[model samples]
Target: MATSEKQVMVVGFDDHEHSAYALEWTLKHFFAPFTSNPPFKLVIVHAKPSPPSVAIPEASEILRYTEADLKKIAARVAESVEEICRNKLENEAIVEVMQGDPRNVLCDAVEKHQASVLVVGCHGYGAIKRAVIGSVSDYCAHHAHCSIMIVKKPKTKH
Candidate 1:
């Protein structure tokens, strides 16, 4: 009764400095004294790109390369990444790897997990360039089902 309920905050992570910055930013801002709760739990989510449509020419007749096969490989990679991240992060988190368009994949994860917040990082693209090329953070900001936090600062290593 004293501690209140805990919600889930889905954080988009790709094992890079930008994404790491977002995670750290959220932790610093939401959690206090580096060890307090923020009314939510951090859930690390990564959207693995869909497998190329190229078929295994030799195995096409029997067992052809399918999206599921590629997903299996991607899952392994995601698992490895999750292990490293979990070991490095100070707070507890959950890891989820999904497939398809990154924008839709991330949004879907938010809805599926019923997350209360989606923390993402700005890719540092200029407005003109972002308008032309598009940005994942932009897409998430517009489409995420929950509250979105876009960390714009670059990671600084001292």
Candidate 2:
């Protein structure tokens, strides 16, 4: 990581927990060198749920977001990301709001942006839950071209 070359893409979701922390961690840990110098870039991705997954609740079908609603939602997601990185990221992170599966959108961004690293947070699912749903963190770890870091939330003892 030199002053002239630094490009990191951080993916975020509606939830502001471990993934957000991981995004910050990516900047502080992985891309520290560039932050200390110059020529650094960070891209934050906020993705909307896809069609089948984002469908209306069970019952008589009622239309959810039309074209306009979708636009508004995307804009809001981008805005939220922008706000988070406004003064926090020293490298001037770029925020993007996309609509689709989180993993797919992130993978596409990684390729399109030529990202050096991809960072995301894990939900910390139990063994059975993970086996059932298939964790995004697991998917990225396997699919990402570059290095992947999955930030795990610190467990609190009851």
Candidate 3:
């Protein structure tokens, strides 16, 4: 039996600091083929909120925003990733944004894209808060089908 080729998809939001760090992380860590090799796809996911005017709608309603806006946000996030990649890996990378839960959506993308690795960032809420609210990274780490990388942001100096 032969090993299948590997692909990577990184998931996160462009608005959050931790997500930005996560993007930086994927660029630094998830190295696929560079020269004459299968390209790795970077996925930056943002959950657009449902508009308030309309009555509560189905899950699909959550992603009602324009694709242009979504792609622009994803591009900005990817630019950060690209900067990190150029400095560290000496290469540019491909990036995309898909809407949904950061965990479920990412895992789904991994399955759809047949990605071997999934990288995401963990934003640490206090233990009490996390116990009640749950964290996206924690969920992904436990449930994702692919090899998962959970990036953590460093503590800020007071």
Clashes of each: 0, 0, 0
Off by over 4 Å in 1: 1-4, 32-38, 55-91, 155-158
Comparing 2 with 3 on TM-score, the higher-scoring candidate is: 2
lDDT tens string, model 1, 21-128?
776677667764446445677777877777555466775544445666767766765676566555555566777787787788889988988888888877798899
| Order of quality (lDDT) | 1, 2, 3
lDDT of 3 at 70: 62
Error of 1 at 71 (Å): 6.7
Sequence-dependent TM-score of model 1:
0.72
What RMSD, rounded to one decimal, does every model reach? 4.4, 4.3, 5.2
Candidate 3 local distance difference test against the native: 0.63
Candidate closer to the true structure by lDDT (higher is better), 2 or 3 = 2
Residue 66 CA displacement from its true place in model 1, Å: 11
- Residue 89 of model 2 has an lDDT of 60
Encode model 3's per-residue lDDT on 1-158: one tens digit a residue: 13564455656555678877877666555543353353565555554422344555674455455545665666676566566556755444555555655657766766777766677767778889988987777777787787877788899999
What is the Cα-based lDDT of residue 18 in candidate 3?
85
Clashing pairs in 3: none
- What's the distance in Å from true for residue 113, model 2? 1.0
